[model samples]
Target: MKKIREIESLLGLPSPSNISVWWNMGSLLGFILVLQLVTGFLLSFHYTADLYCTFNSIIHIMRDVPGGWFLRSMHANGASFFFLLMYIHIGRGIYYQSYMMQPRTWMVGVTIFLVSMGTAFLGYVLPWGQMSYWGATVITNLMSAIPYFGTNLVEWVWGGFSVGQPTLNRFYSLHFLLPFVLSVLVMLHLVFLHEKGSTNPLGSLHHVAKIPFHPYFTIKDIVGVVLLSFIMLGIVFFGPNLFTDPENFIEANPMMTPVHIQPEWYFLYAYAILRSIPSKLGGVLALVFAVTYLYFFPVTMRMNVLPMAYSPISQFFFWQFVVVFGLLTWLGACPVEDPYVNIAPYLTVMYFALPILMQVSNSIWYKLIIS
Candidate 1:
C-alpha cells in the first residue's frame, strides 16, 4: 500500500498546465526504450556473435524464426525512432532553455545521448555486413589517433590487431548490456527532472496553475505514441529497409571496403565534422567536442528567465543552428569529394558557431528586458 501510494504520488505530481506537445517527448522516449529492450531481447535468442556465422544467422532469423522478420524490423526501426525522438527531445530542450534551468537533468540527458550512440554503433556491427565491418573498423581506428596509447587502445577494443571474431563477440556483448545501463540513466534523468520540475514553453510559471500529470499529460503522450506507432508500423511492414544502407546487405569482407563508407543517418552530423578536419587526431577530438560542447550550455546560457522564449534574436540563431545541423547531416552522406567536401568545412564552422551566437544574443536580450 505504501509503495502504491508513492507511485501514485509520483504520477500525480503537479506539472505546469501550459506545457505543450513538445513536453510529451519524454514519455514517448520512455515507451520506445522499453519497446527496443523487449524486441532486442527476443532477437538475441537466435543470434550468433561469431564473425563467420553472424551474417548467416541474421538471414536465418529472417527466414526461419517465425515472425523473426517482424522482430528484426521492429528492433531495427525502433532504433531509428529512438534516435529521432531523442534528437527532437534534445532540440526541444535547447529551444526552451531547458538545459539552463535544469542543469543536472540536462547533463544526465547528454550522457544518455552519448551512451545511446555508443550502444547503437555496437549494434550496427552485429549484422556482420559490409558496412557493419568497415564502419566498425573506421570508427575504432579513430581511437588510434590518441597519443602514445592510441594503437594499444584500438587493439584492446578490437581484441586483436584487426576487427574479427573477438570484435564481433565484444560488440555483441556490449550492445546487449548497454540498454540496461541506458534504462538506469533514463530513470536518473526522470528523477532529476522531477526534482527541478519541467520547463514550459513560457519562460517561467511560478504563479501559474499546476495540473496533475495523470490524465492531462498522459493523454498527450498516448497521442504521440499512437502517431509514432503508425509511422513505425508502416516502415516495419512496408519498408523495413528504408533507412538501411545498401552496402550492409552484402556480407562483411574486410578485403573490400564500400566505395562510400557512411554511418547510419543519426551519426551523419558528427561524421561530417570528423571528415572536415584534415588531421586525424583533430577530427577525432572535434567529433568528441561537438557533442560534449552541450555540457557547457549551463555555463554559457545561464540566466534567471527562460533564455529563448521571448528573445527573437536567440530564436533566429537557434533555427539557423538547426539548418546547419541538417545540412551537415546531408553532407555526411555525400561522396567525400569536391563541391560536397568544400561545403562541409563551412557548415562545420557554422554548426559550432551558432550556439555561441545564440548565447550572446540571449544575454543581450535578457539585459534589455531587465532594463
Candidate 2:
C-alpha cells in the first residue's frame, strides 16, 4: 500500500550516531503515556465525579471491582514514576544539549510535560480524599492573588465560593479530556523530532549520519519499555502506597484540614516554592513564572550555545542541578515549619540559579579555551 511505503520511507530516514541510552528516554516516556491512558480509561469506568460519591466510588473500586485495586494502585504509582522518568529524560536532554539543536522538539516536549502535570493535578482531585479536597482547595485558592480579579477567578474555577461538587465535576471532565490532547501533542512532538531528527551525545547532525527508526531503534525501545514495565509492576503489586499520602486514606472533610497538607510527590517542588514565599500572590506568580521561564532558556541563556558534553564544568553543573531538584522534591513533602521552611528558600534559589550558573560557567570555560 502507498501508506505502508510512505511509512517505510519515514522509518528509513537517518538519525544521529552515538545516541546511547539517553535517546531511549523519549520512547520510554511514550510507553508510560500509553500505560497511563490504558489504566486511566479502565479506572474511569468505575469512578464517579460527584463530590459526595467520589470518595465512596474509589473505595468501592478498591474493595469490590475485580483487579480494581491493582488498576488504581498502578495508575497512582505510575504517575509518580512517570514524573521520575520525565525529570530524568528532561535532564538528559539538557545534559547532552539535545534542546539546543532541536529546539522545537524540546519545546514540544516541555509543553507535553506541562500538560501532563495539569492532567495529573486534575486527576488527583477525583478521589475526593482529605488531601484531594484540600489540595484542590489550596492550589485553586492561589489564583486569588491576581490583584483585582483574583478572588473572582478563584470562584469561577471552583464553580462556587469553595471547592465542592462543581469543582469535582469540572476536574473530572478535564482530566478525561487532557490525555487525548496530550496524545495529539505527542504526535506533534514526534513530527518535530522527525523533522529535525535526533541529536546524539556527540552532537552530530542528522545529515552526517542517520539510520532507520524501525527494527533498529524499535527493538531498543522495546527493551527499555519492558524493563520499565517490570519495575512499575513490582511497585503496583508489592508497594502501592509507598509514595502516596496516608492522610488521603481518609475521606474528604472540608471542616478539618490535615495537620500537614501536601500534594502528590510530583508537585512537591512547586509546593515547596509556594510555601517558601510569604506573599500569596508572589508564591502564585513564582510557580507560574518558574515553568514559563524555562521556555526562554534556549534564548536567554548563553551557555545553550556551547558544545555541552565537551564542557566538563557545564556537565557537572547540569547534574548538580538535578540533585538539587530532587532535594527540593523531598523537602516539599516535609512540614512547612522551622528548618524545612527556612531551608526551602535557599534550596529554591539554587534550583532556579542552576541554569544560569551553567551558562556562566560554560561561557567562561569557552573564553578560557579560546584565549
Candidate 3:
C-alpha cells in the first residue's frame, strides 16, 4: 500500500493548465522508446553481428521468423518516429524558452539527442547492406579530417584499413549498449524536469490554475499516443520500406557503388551542411557546430519572457527560421548538383544567421518593454 501510494503521488504531480498538445509530445516520445526497446530485444534473437552473416541473417529474419518482418519494420520506422518527435520536442523548447527556464533539463535533453544520434548511426551500419557499407565508410572516413593524427584515428575506428568484421562487431556492441545509456539519461532528464516544473507557453503562469498529472495530462497523453499509433501502424503494415533506400536492397559490395550515398532523412540537414563547405575539415567542424549550437542557447542571450512574448519581430523571425529549415531539408534530399550546389551555401549562411538575428530581436524587445 505504501509503495503504491508513492507511485500514485508521482503520477499526480502538478502542472499548469494552459499547456497544449505540444506538451504531450514528450509522453508520445516515451511511448516510442518503449516500442523500440521491445522490438530491438526480440530482433536480437535472430541477428548475427558477423560481416559475412549480417545481410543473410536479416533476410532470414524476414523469411523464417514468424513475425520477424513486422518486428524489424517497427524497429526501423520507430527510429524515424523517434527523431520526428524529438525535433518537435526540441523546437518547442526553443520556442517557449524552456531551455532558459529549465537549463538542467534542457542540457540533459540535448545530451540524450546526441547519444540517440550515435545509437542510430550504430544501428544503421548493422544491416550491412549497400548503403550501410558505404554509409559506414563515408562517416567513419570523416575522422581523417583531424590534423596530424587523423590517419591513426581512422585506423583505430576501422579496426583495419577499412570497415570490416571488426568494425561491425564494435558498432553492434555499441548499438546494443547505447539504448540503455539513453534510458538512464532520460530518467535524469525527467528528474530535472520534475524539479523545475514544466514551462508554460505564456512564460510564467502564477495567475493560472494548476492541476494534477493524472486524469488530466495523462489522459491527454493517451489521446496523443493513440493518434500517433494510427499513422505508425499504417506505415508498419502496408509500406514498411517506404523510408528505406533501394540501394540497400543489394548486398554490400566493396567494388560497386550507388549513384547517390545519402543518409537517413533525419541526418539530411546536417549532411547538407556538411557538403556545403569547400574544405573537408571545415565541413566536419561545421557539422559539429550545427548540433553543438544548442548547448550555447542558454548563454547566448538572456530573455525575461518566452519567444512568443518577446516581441512580434522575434516571432516573425522565428517563423522564417522554420521555413529556412524546411528549405534546407528539401535541398538535402536533392542531388548535390547544379543549382542546389550553389544554393546550399547561401542557405547555410542564413541558417547560422537565424540565432544571431534572434538575440538581436530579444535585445530590442527588452529595451522597449523595460523603458
Candidate 4:
C-alpha cells in the first residue's frame, strides 16, 4: 500500500497542462493492447500451430464456438486498429517535439513498436493460409541477401529450403512469447515517461499549467478507450473482412502462388520498398535497413532542437509524402507487373526524399524567420 501510494504520488505531480485529445493516443494504444491480448488468448485456445490443421482450426472456431466468430474477427481487425493508433501516436510524438524532450522515452517507444511489428509478422504467418505461407516465404528469403552466411541462415530458420511446418511452429512459438516481452517493454516505457514527466503543447518549463494524472487524464483515457472499443466492435460485427486480403481465404499450396502475394497492410510500406528495386538483394537490404535507419534520425539530422512547426512548403511536402506512401501501399497489394514495377522506383524515391526536403525547408524557414 505504501509503495502504491508513493508511485501514485509521483505520477500525480502537476506538469502536463496543455495536453490535448491527441495525447490520448498512447492511452488508447494501451487499451487496444489489452483488448488484443484477451481476444487473442481466446482464439489461441482453438488455434493449432501445425500447418495442416491451423486453417481448419480457425474455421472451426469461427463456425462452431458460440460467439467465436466475433472473437476471431475482433482479433484480426484489432491488429489494423492497433497499427492505426500507433502511427497516430508516433506522429503526435514527432509533431510535438516529445522525442527531443524525452529521448529515452522516444527510443523505448520505438523499440516497443519494432518488437510489436515483429510479433505481428509472426502472428500473420501462423494461420498457414495462402498469403501467410507466401508472405513468410518472400520475407524470410530476404535474409539470403546477407553477404556470406545469408542463405545458410535463412535455411536454418525455415528448417528447410522454404517455408514449411517447421517455420510455422517456430513462428507460433515466438508469436506467443513476444506479447509478454512487449508488456515488459511497455512497463519500462512508462517508467521512463514518469521519470521526465509528460510534455504539453505550450512547450513551457515553468510548471505553470499542471494537474493530477488520476482524476484528469485517467478519466480522459477511459473515455477514449470506450470510444475506440465501440468502433472496434462495430467493425468486428459488420465488416470484419474489410481490412483483410481476399487472397488469404485460400488454403496454402506452395506450388500454386497467389496472383498477388502481399503482406498485411501494416507492412505495405516496407513491402513497397522491397519490390521497388530491380535487384532482389538490393530490395532486401533496403527493406531491412529502412526501419533500422530511423534510429539514426536524431543524430543524422543534426538538429540540436526539434522544430515546433514547419514552413508551408515543408508541410505540403510532408502531406505529399504521406500520399506517396499510400500509393506505395496500394502498389504493394497489386501484382508486381507493369505500372507497379515501373512506378515503384518513383514512389520509393519520394518515400525517402521527404526527410531531406523537410530538412532543407526547415533550414530556409528558420533563416527567414530569424532574418
Candidate 5:
C-alpha cells in the first residue's frame, strides 16, 4: 500500500499549467520505447548474429515466423518514431531553456540521447545488410583516428582485423543489452525531473499555479499517444519501407560497395558534420562534439532569460539553428561532391556558432534590462 501510494502521488504530481502539446512529447517517447522493446525482444528469439546467417535470419523471420513481419516492422519503425519524438522533446527543452532550470535532468537526458544513438547504431548492424555492414565498418574505422591505441581499440571492438562474425555477435549482444540500460537511465531522468518539477512554457516558475497530472495532462498525453499511434501504425502497415535504405535490402558483400552509403535519417546531420571536416581525426572529433555539445548549454547560457519568448534575438538564432540542422540532414544524404560538400563545413560552423550567438544576444538583453 505504501508503494501504491507513492505511485499514486507521482501520478498526481503538480505540473505547469501552461505546458502545451509539446510537453506531451515525453509521454509519447516513453510509449515508443516500450513498443520497440517488446518488438525487439520477440524478434530476437529467431535472430542469428553470424555474419553469413544474419541477413538470412532476418528474411526467415519475415517469411516464416507468424507475425514476425509485424514485429520486425514495428521494431524498425519504432526506432524512427522514438528518435522523432525525442528530437522534438529535446527541441522543446532547448527553446524553453528548460536546461537552465533543471540542469541535472537535462544532462542526464543528453546522456540518454547519446546512449540511445549508440543502441540504435548497434541494432542497425544486426541485420547484416549491405549498408549495415559498411555503415558499421565506416563508423568503427573512425575509431582508428583516436591516436596510438585507436587501431587496437578498433580491432578489439571488431574482435578481428575486420568486421566479421565476432563483430556481428558482439553487436547483437550489446544491442540486446543497451535497452535495459536505457530503461534505467530513463527512470533516473524521471527522478531528476520529479525533483525539479516541470518548467513552464513561459520559463518562469515564480508564483505560477500548477495543476494535477491526472485528468489535465493525462488526457493531453493520451491525445498525443493516440495521434502518434495513428501515424506510426499507418507507417507500419502501409509504408514499412518508407524509412528504410535501399542498400540495406541487399546482403552484405565485402567486395561490392554501394554507390552511395548513408545511415538512417536521424544520423544524417552528424554524418554531414563528419564528412564536412577534411582531416580524419578532426572530423571524428567534430562528430563527437556535435551530439555531445548539449551538455555545455546549462553553464553557457546562465542569463535569467527563462525562455526565448522574452528575447527576440535568441529566438531568431534558435530558428537559424533549426534551419541549419535541417540543411545538414539534407546535405548528409546528398552525394559527397562539389556544392554539397562545400556547403557542409560552412553549415557545421553555423550549427556550432548559433547557440553561442543566442547566449550573447540573451546576455546583452539581460545587461540592458539590468541597467
Candidate 6:
C-alpha cells in the first residue's frame, strides 16, 4: 500500500481534459520501442553479419529455429510501425504547439528520430540481402560528395573501397549497439515530458486543466496499446512482405542492379528528395536538409498562437501540407521516369515551402493581421 502511494505521487498529475486520442501516440511509440528491443535481441542470436554466411544464416533461422520466422517478421514490421507512429506523434505535437512550451523535449525527440533512422538503416544492411547492399552503397556514396576527404571518409565507413565484409561487420556491431543508446534517449525523452508536462489538445498548459496520470492516461494508453497490437499483429502475419521488396530475397550482386533501386519505405521520402536534384552534391545536401529541417524548429518557432486556433488560412494550408507529404511518399515509390520524374521537383518545392508558410502565418498573426 505504501509503495503504491509512493509511485502514485511520482506519476499522478492534473492533466488536460481536452487531450484527445492523438496524445496516445507517445504511449504507442514506447510500446513499439520495447517490442523492437526484445525481438531484435532474439533475432540477432541467429543472424550472421559476414558476407558469405549472413544471407544463409537468415535462411537457417527461418528453416531451423522454431518460430524464428515469426520473431524476425515481428521485428521487421515493428520497425516500420515505429516510424509510422513516431510520425503521428510528431504531427500531433505540431498540431498542439507542444514545441513552443517544451522546446528541449522537442529537441530530444528530434534527436531520437534521427538516431532511430540511423539504427534502422544499420539494421537494414545486416540481412545481407540485395536491397540492403545497394541501399548501403547508394547512401554511403553520398558522403563522398564532400569536398576533399569525402572519398577517404567513405572508405573508412565501408572499411575499404566498397561495402563488403568489414562494412557488414561494422553495421552489425552498431545495429546491436544503437538500440541501447536509443533506450537511454527514450528515458531522457520521458524525463523531459514529465518535467515540462504534456500539452493539451486545446493548446492550453493551464494548471487548472491538469489531471491525474494513472487512472485516466494509464487506462487510455492500455486501450491504445491493445488497438495497436491488433493492427501490427495482422501486418506481421498476413502481409509480412508487403512493405519489403522482392529483390531483397535474392543474394546481393555488385555486378547487377535492379531496374528500380530504392531504400525501404521509411527512407523513400528522403530518397526522393535526393533523386529530385540533378547534381550529386546538390541531391546530398537536399537529403541532409530534408531530414534535419526539424532541427531548426526551436529557432524557427515564432508562433503567434496555437496552430489549431491560428488563421484558417494556415489551417487549410496545414492540411495541404499533409497532402503534399503523402504525395511525396507516394511519388517517391514511383519510378525515376516520366511524370514522377517531373513531378518530384515540384513536390520537393512544396515540401520545403511548408516551414516558411508556418513562419509567415505566425508572423502575420502576431503582427499586422491580429492587431
**What residue runs in model 5 are displaced by over 4 Å at the alpha carbon?**
none
* Tens digits of per-residue lDDT for model 6, 1-371: 99998688756866777788999998899999999999989988888887999999999988899999889888989999999999888877776668787888999999999999999999888887888899899889899999999999999999998999999999999999999999999889888887757877666667776778879889999999999999998987899888888999999889998778788888888888888999999999999989888878777777465456656656766777778778888877899889898988998898899767866776676566556
Off by over 4 Å in 2: 302-304
lDDT tens readout by residue for model 1, 135-223: 99999999999999999999999999999988988899999999999999999999998875777787563636788889888888898
The lDDT, on a scale of 0 to 1, for candidate 1 is 0.91
Residue 66, model 6: lDDT of 95
Q: What is the lDDT of residue 222 in candidate 3?
A: 91
- Candidate 4, residue 294: the lDDT equals 54
Better of 1 and 3 by TM-score: 1
Clashing pairs in 2: 14-210, 14-211, 15-210, 15-211
lDDT of 3 by residue, 1-371 (tens): 99999889778778888889899889998999989999999999999998788999999999999999999999999999999999999988878878788888988999999999999999999999999999999998999999999999999999999999889999998998899999999999999988857878876635357788889988888989999999999999999999998988899999998888988888888888888999999999998998888998878767554356647877777778777777887787889798998988888888888877876887788788878
* lDDT-best of 2 and 4: 2
Estimate, for each residue in 1-371, the C-alpha lDDT of model 5 and write its tens digit: 99999988898888988888888888988999999889999999999887678899999999999999999999998998899889889989999998898999999999999999999999999988899999999999999999899999999999999999999889988999999999999999999999868989788655459888888888888888898889988998999999999999999999998998899999999999999999999999999999999999988877555368888988999999999999999999999899999999999999999999988898888778778
Q: Kindly report the root-mean-square deviation of model 3 from the true structure over all alpha carbons.
A: 1.4
Which sections of candidate 3 miss by over 4 Å? Answer: 205-208, 304-307
lDDT of 4 at 119: 91
Count of backbone clashes, every candidate in sequence: 0, 4, 0, 0, 0, 5
Position 72, candidate 5: lDDT: 95
lDDT per residue as tens, model 2, 1-371 = 99999899777867665678878888888888888899999999999887678899999999999999999998898888888888888888778777777788888888998999999999888888899899999889888889899899999999999999988889999999999999999999999888768887876664776677777888888999999989988988888889888888899999998998888888888888877889888888878876666687677655334678778998888888888888888998898778888998888788888888888888888888888
Q: How accurate locally is residue 190 in candidate 3, as Cα lDDT from 0 to 100?
A: 92
TM-score of each: 0.98, 0.96, 0.97, 0.93, 0.98, 0.96
- Per-residue lDDT for 176 in model 2? 91
Q: In model 4, where do residues sit more than 4 Å from their true spots?
A: 202-206, 301-306, 310-313
lDDT, candidate 1, at 341: 93
